[model samples]
Target: MLKTILSISGKPGLYRLLSSGKNTLIVESLQTKKRIPVLPKDRVVSLGDISMFTDGEDIALSEVLTRLHEKQAGVAVSEELLKDSDALRNSFGEVIPNFDRERVYTSDIKKLYTWYNILIEAGITDFADQDEAE
Candidate 1:
């Protein structure tokens, strides 16, 4: 079965969509390779994952949790369960974690434009130099 894996870009452990018929999420320990099954209805909480304000594709954790709540899905993991935990996964049907992208990282248009020119000057985009605007 195809599983959607979710994880911090630099983290080791991954949250995987294992089975959905019963709404189960599989949290796998990348180091020990241990698998922990989590249910959406099991109000659970976790800590130490260290997900930051800029996590989840620049989206905050609260937003993700909010969407989950609207669907009647339990908070799933209680804070007690995740105090010393490593990671989490979503195993709902067609598990596709939504993300909020209203805010983007700080950047200067002039700086970015200049940087793009630098890349072009360095011949990084040599193949597609058909239009400098690109």
Candidate 2:
């Protein structure tokens, strides 16, 4: 689920990791269904490998998303929250109260919300809970 999805630097939106090549990883755009070869030099990162800075320790992206999902009662995040920085920060604060405000940019919060919406629309929720159990 979240582990197989990726966000490449300089790319437009999310991509589904398809396979690995000699020098690049094959990925398909979740939005357009178009496949592309991503180089190792690209800042390609699995969503699962992402974590946010917290007061005690960094928390996994999946955990943050789970908190977001629960906060919204399994509904899509509001558009205002995505567009408005102040609202977005407030909402994100409710989810990850200790996320480093100085380190985490407003753009990062917007991207996180957008990615969560995309994953939810693609029916990628079950795996987060499973990852927590393990």
Candidate 3:
């Protein structure tokens, strides 16, 4: 589920939590399908725990992704189009109208799109499954 998926800072792709060690967590890269150990010092966050700042309040990543999924009719958005910050912001704005422009950068937007595509390719589209897993 979404909770098991993580986005590590400075990492190029998403990882799936596999197991926990004494001071590290084993994770499998969604892109490479290779497993690696994440040290305690590494900046890691569960997709389920991530939220974006909005004008009124924080919006969960799940909500934003769900809205995007609905908007695109469950299909992945074009990666090429998402490369442009202006386009990314416009697309994201449609999903979360009040998302904080100052806090969310182009890199963040790209990461969200990349992660969403990875999730979709891995057949992790069941939002209900994510909720039940929590």
Please tell me which predicted candidate would have the highest TM-score against the true structure: 2
List the global CA lDDT of all models.
Answer: 0.33, 0.86, 0.83
Cα RMSD (angstroms) for every candidate in the order listed = 19.4, 1.9, 2.1
- Give Cα distance to truth, residue 103, candidate 1, Å: 2.6
Model 2, span 1-134: residue lDDT tens: 67889999999889998999789899998878899999978998888788988878999888898898899888888787788899899889999999999899999999899998887787677547356677
Best first by lDDT, ranked: 2, 3, 1
How well is each residue in 1-134 modelled by candidate 3, as lDDT tens digits?
A: 67888888888788999999899999999878999999988999988888888988897887878887888788888977676889888988888888899998878888788888888887777644346456
For each candidate in turn, the TM-score is 0.24, 0.88, 0.87
User: Which of 1 and 2 is the better model by TM-score?
Assistant: 2
- After best superposition, candidate 1 residue 3: deviation in angstroms? 6.1
Residue pairs with colliding backbones in model 1 are: 44-76, 44-77, 44-78, 45-77, 45-78, 45-79, 46-82, 47-82
Instruction: Give candidate 2 misplaced runs (Cα > 4 Å).
Output: 127-132
Candidate order by TM-score, decreasing, is: 2, 3, 1
Lowest lDDT block of 10, candidate 2: 123-132
Which stretches of model 3 miss by more than 4 angstroms? 128-134
